[model samples]
Structures are given as structure tokens and as C-alpha cells.
Target: MANLLSLFKTSGIFHLTPGMVIMWLISLTLIYLAISKQYEPLLLLPIGFGILVVNLPLADLMKPHEGLIWRFYHYGVQWEVIPPLIFLGIGALTDFGPLLARPGLIFLGAGAQAGVYVTFFAANAMGFSVNESATIGIIGGADGPTTIFLAAKLAPHMLGSCAVAAYSYMALVPIIQPPIMRLLTTREERVIRMKKLRKVGRLEKLLFPIISTIVIILLVPAAAPLMAMFMLGNLFREAKVVERLTNVAQNELLNIVTIFLGISVGATMNADNFLQAKIIFIFCLGLFAFCVSTAAGVLLAKLMNLFLKDKINPLLGAAGVSAVPMAARVVHKVGAQEDKKNYLLMYAMGPNVAGVIGTVIAAGIFSTILK
Candidate 1:
């Protein structure tokens, strides 16, 4: 009987808790979303699998010094390597032409950041510490790597939940933004067409990274790690002389880092840290931040229309939340619902890319103040 009981004790099933089972279900749901709904699959699928992996009773995947995932998390995220690499890939894939074609659209990106600040105060008011509140606030920007980067700095405990929130909402941009876009604007406003953007030369595209790198890094020295790599990737793309380097950054390097980033982030969501009331609140606050950011962007575009002779499509403003092409594509789709002939995609990319910069800048600001 003693030997029998001892043998049972060694089995994972004997040690499993209800919370671990619950985490498994949650992780599986995420996997379903990634596989069936195709929602941020590149990250979510790995994240879900990681969650499942860590929750097994005796696996000890995230067990401090000895764990495999612990090493990945420590080196890739905690040491701040992966997020910058992710940004490098993002910069390589990005095109500044649309943003350069129309400089005024940058304001929409800046305007969308209202939610981040607003949520910072709201989260603080709800009894979270300043550091945790800042982590929660950044979810509104809808940039996963930035959220992870900030969470790793200000609130490492909340990194998994915060990252999941950011990516989940980013995937749901098509569902979330359209309702807010419609709520804020009249049908006439959605149909409004802006003037054609002027042509931007390759010189301007090449110069943007250099000028932006100098200006942004000067203003936010804390942003150097991310901003520097981001700009360098863009420079590689724009230079046209580093096709091999650019291709690797855009494809292989990005793919590898994304896998590490996703799994490492997911591994943090073990039942002990994740199954809390505060986690629920974090998700709620993330949704609130996303909604407010969407609203703020649309309203700002309306306000901008008041001053300018050439009107801007209010739908374009919805793209200012750093979900990249998805946010921009949603903006185009919403505008097309009003007028199929209207081509708002090119115009929307301006704010879409700008939002990426805005979110990164916001993360840098938070790191400076809170770190």
C-alpha cells in the first residue's frame, strides 16, 4: 500500500488541480480561435500550446532556473532581445510611402493614444499600482510586442495576460472597430473622400528612418533599443542595397523570434498567476482601452476635417491603433460599405503605420517613467 500510494504520487494526474484544468480549457479555447477562426494564429497557436504545456502538474516548464521555457523567457523577453527583433521585422515589412504622402494623418495616430493615458488613470483608480496600470494601459495600442516589452519592465507578473489581451483584441479589430466607427460617424462622413496624396520619393522614404531615428531616440532615449532596430530594418528595406539582409529580417528572423516570443509569453500564463480576479479586470480594461482608442481616433479625424479644405475619411482614423494592415483593412472595408467606389485603403495605411510608431513611443514613455 505504501509503494502503491508513492507510485500514484508520482503521476501528474494525481497532482492536478481544478485551476490547472481550467487553464487547459482556456488554452484550448485560444487554440480553437487560432486554428478555426485564424485569429492571430502565428502567436496565439503557440501561446495556447505553451499555456497547455506549462500547466501540466510536474512538467515544470517555467520552473525558475532549471526549466526550458524559463530560459527562453529569461533570455528572449526578460533580457529584452525578442521584442526588438520583432520590431526589426515589422520595420522591414513597413512602407512609409503612405504616411509620407500625407503628413497630417500622423495626428490620428497620436490621437488614438488617448485611450492609453485614459486607461492608465482608470487602472490606477481601481487600486492597481502605477506600474501595473501602465502595463494595462498599453493594451489599447494593440501592439503585442510593445505591450510585452512594457509588461516585462513594469509588470512582469501581468505579461501573459496583457500580451493575450493585446493580441486577442488586435485579431478582433474587424469586429470591434467597425461598430465604434459606425457609432461615431454619420453615413455621409464615412462616404467622404479625401484628396489624392502627393507622390513621395524614394529619398524621402530613405530619409524618414534616419530623421525619425534621430528625433525619436533623442526625445525618448529609453526607446532606443526598439526604435533603433525598427529604424535599422526600415533603412535596410529602403536602401535597396541589402536585399539579402532585408529578406532575412522580414522572413526567417521574424519567424524564429515570433515563435520564441509566443511560446515564452504563453508559458507565463500558468494557473497560479493567471487565475485571478485581476486578470478578468485586465481583460475588461483592455477592451475599454481599445474602444476608447477607436472612438478617439474617429472623433479626431472629424475635428481635423473642420480645419482642412480637403476632407479626410473618418474611417481612416480607426486604423490608428497599431494593428497594422488589419486595422487599415478594416477601415477600408467599413468605408466601402458606405461607398464601394471609395478607395480608403491607401489613405488608411498612413495612420496605420503611424500608429505603430505612436504605440512604440508610448511604450518608451511608459518605460522611462515607470522603469
Candidate 2:
């Protein structure tokens, strides 16, 4: 009996404690938010599960390079393989017609990226190394996969802080964007009506992604993996004959990738690695980046309106932050609050899609500078 008891204690399999259990409960809160509040559950669910698994105190699941979780951690994540795959899914899901129909909003998308750069500098000032700062700055783009992709490459150690910040700020887009939008634009600017979007033909839709892939790859070769894959997935969707592939990209492929990616990410968040003062700084810098991105997008549009015959609604600029349809919808809702007849959903999509492209470009820039 004594030898058996000693063996169990030595293994640490029976040493589960109250503090570790509490951490598991806290992680569950993240899961509840993802599941109940509908805040990026695709990521939070598996991430939450990973946290629970790793924190069990007795589980060998995260034991460096030996455990099963560690294999996933080393294979898919450490080598920067998952982000491009996830981007393919995003590309398959994105509708670039709105962006193609309105090219001017592309500038708004670029303008929103100013926040990303600013956050990079801010994080550096706060004492993060250049690579770590760059990873955190991406949170302003509100592109979860891009952030994960970059963090995995540049500062794998900071993945948890960067990923959590990216997703959390994405969920708060409706909340964070509106106040900045309202503060930047006047009632008249909010109520400006936009011309109806021209119907983008199938040829244009197909050419858009193809052309984008070529141009971006030529300009920023580092973006090829993410951008090319994204365009290919989009091509699959727009090809008109790949329904099966598109459906898989949209549902099965995306869901499965998200689950694996999330858990893999969470497993990296062992207390020794995750609980740090730098993480709090990263979190603050992320929020700072998000707010600045919102403000920059709105104000840039206001500036553009001064020189154009057709005034661009400043509200649409908020959508440039890349939370996708959510940011666009927030612009639509806030505009509707000012004048019920005003509708900006279609117009907002231009910047919304641009934000996606902008974030990818930002990721490319990070990849280059980090290299």
C-alpha cells in the first residue's frame, strides 16, 4: 500500500488542487461568453476547453514536446501553418463585390491601419520588444487569424495575450466603434445617403481575388501564403462550380480548423507562460489600438469628403477596422439612430472588406520587419 501510494504521488496524477480548479472555472467563463453571449464561440469554445485541460494540475497533456497537445503545438502552430489555412476559410466566406464596386473605400481601409502602426510604437514605448510589440499591434486590425498567424511566427510566446485581445476587441466592435464614430462625425455626416452599389458581375468577382492575390504577392511577398490561400478559397466560392468545396470551407473545414486552432492556442497559456506583467500591457495596448483604428477611419473619411463631389459618409469609415459585417452593421445601426431612413450597410461593406485586406497587408509588413 505504501509503495502504491508513493507511486501515485510521484506521478502527480492525484495532486489536483483547489487553485487549479478555480482557474478551470475562470476559463469556463470564457466558454460561457463564447457559447451564451455568442462572442466568437468558434475560437473561445476550444480555447476554453484547452485551458481546462491544461490546468487540471495532473494532466500530462501539455508536457512540453512529449504530450499529444504538444505535438499539435509544435507541428501546426509553431511552424505557422494554421493561419493560412484559416485565411482560406475567411476568403471563402468574404464577399468582395462590395469592395470592388466602391474602390474609394479602400483608402479608408488603409487609413484604419494607421492605428495598427501607432499601437506598434505604443507597445514599444511600453517596453515590449519590437517583435512582441508588432504582434500586439495587430489586435487593432481586429483580424483574429491574422493576429494568430503573426504571433505564431514572430513571438509565439505572446500568442495568448495577442489572441485574446484580438477576439475580445472584435466582440466589442459594436461597443467601441460607435462612440468613436459618433464623436468623430456630425449628424449631417451620419445621415448622408450613398448611391446604390452597382451589381458586380461574376467575372469581376472572380477577377477581384485573382488580381488581389497577384498584386499583393508582388508588393508584399510575405503575404502570399495568407493572401494567396485567401484568394483561392474565395475563387472556390466564386467559381460557380465548386459548391461542395465552398460548403466545406464555410462549415466543416472552418469549424474543425477553429477547434484545433483554439485548443492549440489555449494549451500554450500555461500559467508560467501566460501570467505576466507584459500581458496586461499587451491587453491595454490592444484596446488603445482598437480605439485609435476606429477614430482614424472615421476622420479620414471626413477629410476625404472635403475634396470630393460625392461626399463619403464618415460613418462608413468605422467599418474599416475589419470586424467584417459586424462593424458594417454597427455603422448601419448608428446611422439609423440619427435618421431612420438613412441606410449604410451596402456602403459600409466597402470599407469592411478593405479592412480585411488592410489587415493582411499589415501582417505582411510585420512578417517582413520581423524577419
Candidate 3:
């Protein structure tokens, strides 16, 4: 009988807690969504697996003294390595052709970041430090890797929740952005038609990343690593000499890093750290940031229209959040509603990628000022 009692104490069943079970279920839900519904699988799959690992009874996924996940995290995230590496993949895939074809859209990217600062001050009001608030505000930019990079640098303690929120919301951009787009811009404004972009010369494409890196790095050297990696990838693509390197960077490299990043992020969501009042507040603030960003993009476009002889389809402004292809697609779709012939996908790409660059710049700013 005493031996039976001892066995029970050591059993996995006895070690389970309600919170663990709940988290396990949540993880499973994320996996299911990734599989069946096809929502952000590149990230959700690893995050779900990480959640499963961490929530298991006596699993030391986050045990600082010794944990597999924790060790991976220390090497991957805390050291500020993987996020910038992913930026290489992002840079590889990005065609700066659209952006170079239209330089004015750069301000739309910069203007959208107004939400980042607004959310930061508000977070400081709510008792978060400068770094923590800055991390929280970046959610509005809707660029996942930038959020991960910034949070890792400024507030590693909040990495798991902030990353999850950032990426999860990015995946939900279709749901979150449209409502804000409609609220901020009128149907007529959304219907405005943009002219075809000027054909970009291959030379301009090659020159863009080189010139941008020099200018932006001169302005904010802290952004050098991310901005440099991103520009190098663009240069590689434009050089037309390293096709294989570009392919690997765009696909396999991105995929592998995404899996590791997701799992590492999900592992950070253990009960003690995640189930807090601040987590809820983080979600709210992130949503606010996204909306404010969308509004800024639209409003800024309206301001630009005042001087320009040719009008821009204001709906494309929403693409300034930097979710890349997704936000660009959203702009195209919304524009098509007004006139099927008025597709804005290529034009939207300028702000789409610019948003990514803008977010990195904002992260550099926050890290510099706060740190």
C-alpha cells in the first residue's frame, strides 16, 4: 500500500494541473487552426508544439536552471540572432522595385508608425517601462519579426506574449484591418483610382538597397544589422548572380527559422508569466496600435493627395502596416471592389515592404532611446 502511494505521487497524472491542461488544449487548437483552417502554419505549428512541450507535467521547457526550450531560447532569441536572420529571408523575398518606382510612399510607411509612439506613452501611463511599452506598441505595425527583434532586445521578459500577439494578429490582418480601413476612410476615398506605376529600371532596383542601406544606417546605426541583412538579400536578388542563395534564403531558411521562432515564442507562455492583467492589456494595446497605424496610412495618403496631380487609391494606405503580401493583397481586393480594373497590388507593394523597413527603423529608435 505504501509503495502504491509512492507510485501515485510520482505518476504523471498526479503531476498535471488545470492550467497545464488548459494550455495544452489551447496549443492543440492552434495546431488544428494551422492544419485544417490554414492560419499562419509557418508559425502556428511550431508554437503549438512548443506549447505542448512546455505544458506537459514536469516539463522544464522554461525551467531556467535547466530546460531544452530555455536553452534554445537563450541561444536563438535572447542573443538577438534569429529575428535579424529572418530579416534576411524577408529581404530576399522583397522586390524593392515597387518602392523605388515610388519614393513618396516611404512617408506613408513612416507615418503609420505614429501608433508605435502613441501606444508607448500610453503603456508608460499604465506602469510599463519605456522598453516594455515600446515592445507592446510595435504590435500596431503588424510586422511579426520586427516585434520579436525589438522585444528580444528591449524586454526579453515579454517575448513570448508579445511575439504571439504580434504574429497572431498579423495572421488575422484580414479580420482586423478591414474594419479599421472602413472606419477611417469613406467608400468614395477607397474607390479612388491610382495610375499605373512607372516601369522601374533594373539599375534602379540594384541601386535602391545600396542607397537605402547607406542612408538609413547613417541615420540609425542600431538598425545596421537588420537593415544591412535585408539590403544584402535585395542586392543578391538584383545582382542576378546568386539565384540559388536567394531561393534558399527565401524558402528553406525562412521556414526553418520560422518553426524555431514559433516554438521558442510559445515556450515563453507558461502560466505564471502569461496569465496576467497585462497580457490582456497587451492584446488591447496591440489592436489599438494596428488600428492607429491603418488610420495614419490612410490619412497620410489623403494629405498627399492635396498636392499630387494624380490621386492614389486611399485604400492602399492600409497596406502600410507591413504584413507584406497579405496587406498588399488586401489593398488590391478592396480597390477591386470599386472597379475590378483598378487593381492596386503592385502599387501597394511599395508601402507593404516599406512598412517592414519602417517597423525596423521604429524598433531601432525605441531600442536606442529606451535602452
Candidate 4:
């Protein structure tokens, strides 16, 4: 009887605590969102399942040096291997034609980075360390892999919270961006249409990745890992002879890494580390960062219209957040609402793609300064 009772005490049911229960609920919520809402299901599903696995009593899934999930976390995230590979896939999939046709839109992408700086100051004021503040601030950039990379390097303790905040805000881009965008721009500004983009030749497309890699790396060497992989992927796509490599990079390679990355990141969210006042603070600051980024992009576009002969729809500025195609789509949908004839998707893509580069550069700058 004594031995049986001792075994029972060691059982998961006997060991469960309020924190564990709460984390289970959180995990379930993430799973529900993934299945029902189709919100980043590829990532959220694996992450949510990981959360469930790690939180189970006596599972030890996140225990250092002994746990299966820990191996994933250590080799992929702690070693800093996954994020840059994700960037490689992004590069292969991206089309820089729109951005090349309108080089000035890069400013809009740059301006959107204001959110990162502003949130950094706010996080610091709220008593986070410089590293933590910077990690939290990068959530504004809306680049999930970049956010994770910076957090893993600078503030590993807060990696789970920062990553969750970044991805959650990214998934909610449509919800978060439109309100701020409308507040910042007039209906006329939203509906303003510009001239058509000029055609970009194959040579320019082929040279862009090479030139950009050289120039950007010369400016920020710390950014080389991500920049190199991103440019390499782009080169593979534009090379026209590397179809197999491009397909592998963009599809199979990305999918495999994403599963490992999501599960590993989620395992870090063990109840003890995740359910804290600081987590709440990080989430609130993340939303602020995202809103500020969207507004800054729109406002900068409005500002530029003052100097340019042809007017740019301020709505395109909202695409300056590095949420990629989602931010661009939001700009298009909002513009279409204001004027049914408005077709802003392609125009928005210029700043949208530029925003990806801006976020990476911003991460490089932060890593250099803080690390």
C-alpha cells in the first residue's frame, strides 16, 4: 500500500498545480485558434502541442541535457540555426520586382522601424534590462524569425514570451493595422493612386541579391548570417537554372525547420517562466509596438507626398511593417474599401518587401549594440 501510494504521488495527476493547469488551458487556446481560426496553423499547431507536452507533470520535456524537446530547443534555437534558414526560405519566395521599380518606398520600410525604437524606450522605462527591452522592441518589426534570433542572442530567458508576442501580433496584423492606419490617414490619402511601375529586367533581378548582399553586409557585418542566406535563396530563385534548389529551400527546407523551430520555441514556455507579470507587460508593449509601426509607416508616406510630384497612397505605408504579404493585403483591402477601383496590392508589395530588409537591418543593429 505504501509503495502504491508513493507511485501515485509521483504520477502526473498528483503533481499537477494551478500553474500547470493554466498553461494547459493556454495551450488548448492556441490549438483551438490554429484549428478553428486557421491562424498560422502550421506554426501554432506545433507550438501549441509543444506547450501541452512540456507542461505535463513529470514529462521533463524541457529539462536541460535530458529531454527530447530540449534537444530541439538547444540545437535549433539556442544554437541560432533555425531563424536564418527561415530567412533563406523567405528570400527564395520573395519577388523584388515591385520594390526594385520603386526604390523610394524603402524609406517607408525604414520609417516603420520607428515602432521598434519607441517600444525599446518604453520597455526600458518599464524597468526591463537593455537586452530585454531590445528583444521586446523587435516585436514591432513583425518579423518573427528576426525577433526570435535577437531574443535568443540577447535575452534567452524571455525568448518564449517575446516570440509569442511577435507571432501573435503578426497574425493579428489585419486587426491591429487598419484602425491605426485609418486614424493616421485621410480617405483621400488612402485612395490616392500612383502611376504604373516600370518593368524590371532579368538582369536587374539577378543582380539585386548580389548587390544588396554586398552593400548590406558591408554596412552591418553582424547581419551576415541572415543576409547571406536570404540573398543566396533569392539568387537561387533568380538564377533560372536552380529550380530544384529553390524548391528545396522555399518548401521542404522551410517546412522542416519551421516544425522544429515552433516546437522548440514553445517548449521554452514552461509554466514557471511564462506565467509572470513580465509576460503580461511584454504582451502589452508588443501591441503598442505593432500599432506605432503601422502608424509611422503611413505618416512617413504622407510626409513624402509633400515633396514628390506624384502622390503615393498613404495606405501603402502600412505595408512597411514586416508582416510580409499580410500587411500588404491589409493596405489593399483598406484602400479598396475607400475606393472600389483602388488596386494597391502590387504597389504595397514594394514597401512590404522592403520592410523585411529593414527589420533584418534593425535586428543587426540591435545585436551589434546590445551584444
TM-score of each: 0.99, 0.95, 0.96, 0.99
Instruction: Put down candidate 3 lDDT per residue, 114-220, tens digits, no spaces.
Output: 88878998888999988899999999888888898888888887888888788788888888777777777777778787776788998998998899999999998
Please give the CA lDDT of all the candidate structures: 0.95, 0.87, 0.85, 0.92
lDDT tens digits, residues 1-371, model 4? 99999999989999898998899999999999989998888888888889889999899988899999999999999898999999999999999999999999999999999999999999999999999999999999999999999999999999988888888888899898999999998877877987899999999999999999999999998888889999999999999898999999999999999999999988989889999989999999988998899989999999999999989999999999999899999999999998989899999999999999999999999999987
lDDT agreement of model 1 with the native = 0.95
Using TM-score as the yardstick, the better of models 1 and 3 is 1
Q: In candidate 2, which residue pairs get closer than 3 Å at backbone N, Cα or C atoms, i.e. clash? A: none
lDDT of 4 at 269: 91
Write down the lDDT that model 4 would get: 0.92
* Whole-structure CA lDDT of model 2: 0.87
Ordering by TM-score:
1, 4, 3, 2
Weakest lDDT window of 10 consecutive positions for candidate 2: 17-26
TM-score of 2: 0.95
Model 1 agreement with the true structure over 46-137: per-residue lDDT tens digits: 99999999999999989899999999999999999999999999999999899999999999999999899999999999999999999999
Model 1: residues with Cα > 4 Å off, grouped in runs: none
Which regions of candidate 2 fall more than 4 Å away from where they truly are? 4-8, 11-22
Q: Judged by lDDT, which candidate is best?
A: 1
Error of 2 at 204 (Å): 1.3
